[model samples]
Target: MDELKVKKSPLERAKMTLSVLALIIIAACSKVEGQADLQKRQGEETPIQVVSTIGMITDVVREVGGDEVDVNGLMGPGVDPHLYKASQGDVGKLDKADIIFYGGLHLEGKMTEIFKKLERQKRTIAVSKNINPKLLRSGKDAGGSEYDPHIWFNVKHWVSATETIRDTLSEYDPEHAEKYRQNADHYIRQLNELNAEVKERIKEIPESGRVLVTAHDAFGYFGDAYGIKVMGLQGISTASEYGSKDVSKLRDYLVENKIKAVFVESSIPTKSMEAVIAGAAEKGHTVKIGGELYSDSLGEPGSDADTYVKMVRHNVNTIVEALK
Candidate 1:
């Protein structure tokens, strides 16, 4: 007969579990310390550390900072900032950044609290804040925000933001101020050309076809800048919810105005817009998805709309081709 095995007491089992958790915690602490040490060593030799919230800011930082700065974009292609929140990893990135840039005016809705906290101690700047108040469109109806945050839609406004980025980077890293200025000058020229090109391309569409409709009200500045009438099912922020009433309103508008095409934003879902499309069809109106617009974010790397200029051009071309 085998001896009966004695089970450990609950207390003994609990102690063992505690011991295991302690060891795990210690290991994690050690790993984090090791990573910090490595980062510290690397930082001694690296360029200015920059963290930007959106791809548009990231692109501008990289272009202006050039080889003088290391820029990390927190939000990537198709990432909507309006609903994005900071994670533990993002906290670490923000902690390590010498400078941070974001679109202001509540564009980063969920991250506003974190940004407000960081503003107390860090060089967290809002690029959109550089825009003139007279130029900003109001989004008061959409969650009571004072102004629209989608300044990038207007090429001229974006150009102003680029200068702001340049000035900020230059102020922080004066050693590379000349380089930044040169880069900014060159980029500004490119942006000017892009603006000209966009105007020319948009001219391809007749005045009757210049109405722009989309899932959200992101294209207000674009429409204002380029002579188009814009409508949206939802408000400025994607965080805003659209209901049956909104959908019905847009459906009726589409049918009444004979707007043939609506665009889907890369960073926003197409579900709502799809419903609008179906609703219009049911009402005996034909509306198609003109193309994917780079509204809140840029396209992925190696794509045609990866860069800011490319993105603006792509959007302009799409709008023109669809509406023409």
Candidate 2:
């Protein structure tokens, strides 16, 4: 025999039906929230891992990439890129980087092979590669003709490099393209202003007195941009050796021109320029060491010439004060 089922009141049935609908609504909301959370996690992106060969390039990357990238420089203050060789730690950094930037045109001569190898695996860019060939200065090294890699000396040329950095970063990370462009525009404007200011400050020196002499020919672009005559005891690359003849030639130029000052480079030794100074004194010309100029690298952190802009300003002030 089967037991009889009890009949429910109409209000009770309505309440039970409402409870079932509420349970369904609650479950659906939880599912939607879970999906929303998953999407939020997926939408978050990590900063781009960037490795640069020089301090200047690292600074540009930092400026343009902003918080979107993390930049590491292989060379630091007072390090010479022409003579710098990548170490095991640098290799590890490059391997881990999502992108790599280097001053091309054989600036990092010793690291060329390493960069070439890494290019096959990731995006490796030479900031100077896209620059106009006519804008570049050509010179002869021991290996014959080569373009000078010291393009950063010219504010305008470095502006071009900054644009290249912005474009490269934008192309690689399109999501942040607008930010990169904005940052680059701001930086380029500052560079242009810097260029104009440099031109004006250079005029403080008498035309005849506007001469720059250094241990290496790294300031060709600087001299060209600022309308000053430049002479160096050594060739473009610091790797080049200078003999007594080179020193004699440079010393005679200083003496004959009646140039009052010669500058030493931050990345190079002062002994070489000191020798030239002594040689000039022996010739009855009193040439003094103007000051140290930031050549291949920026100054140490918190120094006057630590950043690219400050470095240029410091160099110009030193030159004008000593030569003018």
lDDT of 1 at 32: 100
Pairs that collide, model 1: none
Instruction: Estimate candidate 1's alpha-carbon lDDT, on a 0 to 1 scale.
Output: 0.91
Candidate 1 accuracy as TM-score: 0.86
TM-scores of the candidates are 0.86, 0.86
Cα lDDT, model 1, residue 256: 95
Question: RMSD, each candidate, Å?
Answer: 8.6, 11.8
**In order, how many clashes per candidate?**
0, 0
Quality of model 2 by C-alpha lDDT: 0.90
Those runs of model 1 whose alpha carbons end farther than 4 Å from true positions after fitting are 1-45
What lDDT does the true structure give each of the candidates?
0.91, 0.90
Q: Write the per-residue lDDT of candidate 2 for residues 31-125, one digit (tens) a residue.
A: 99999999985798878999998898898898889999999999999999989988899999999998999998888977988888888999999
Write one digit per residue (lDDT tens) for candidate 1, span 1-324: 999999999999999999999999999999999999999977776688999998999999998999889999999999998989889999999998999898989999968778888998889999987787998999997652799898999999989999999999989878779999999999999999988888888889999989999888999999898889998888999888889999999999999989999999998889989999999999999999999999999999999999999999899989998999
